[model samples]
Target: MLYPSNYVNKIIYRIKWVTQKNIEAVENKALKKEELKEKIRKNSSVNG
Candidate 1:
């Protein structure tokens, strides 16, 4: 039996795209948390 190569390539590409998007979302959440921590530290230093 023979199969079309393009169909396999398309599935691989979609899986890769979804994996990359998930990684980016996790990274963005981590970055936001770090920024919040820095802001809190600065505020506490000024008030103290």
Candidate 2:
């Protein structure tokens, strides 16, 4: 059986694309967590 020359490369490219998307999602979550921590600190300082 013969396959197209770039078929394997295309598959790898798709996998990379999916991984990048997941990484971005996690990064966004971490950023939000940091922002929440900052807000809590500010609120506690103001109240105390």
* Each prediction's RMSD to truth: 1.8, 1.7
Q: What is the lDDT of residue 21 in candidate 1?
A: 100
Cα deviation of 25, candidate 2, in Å: 0.9
lDDT of 1 by residue, 1-48 (tens): 756999989988999999999999999999999999999999999999
Count of backbone clashes, every candidate in sequence: 0, 0
The residue-by-residue lDDT of candidate 2 on 1-48, one tens digit each, is 867869978988999999999999999999999999999999999999
Off by over 4 Å in 2: 1-3
Candidate 2 Cα deviation (angstroms), residue 47: 1.1
lDDT of each: 0.97, 0.96
C-alpha positional error of residue 37 in candidate 1 after TM-score superposition, expressed in Å:
0.5
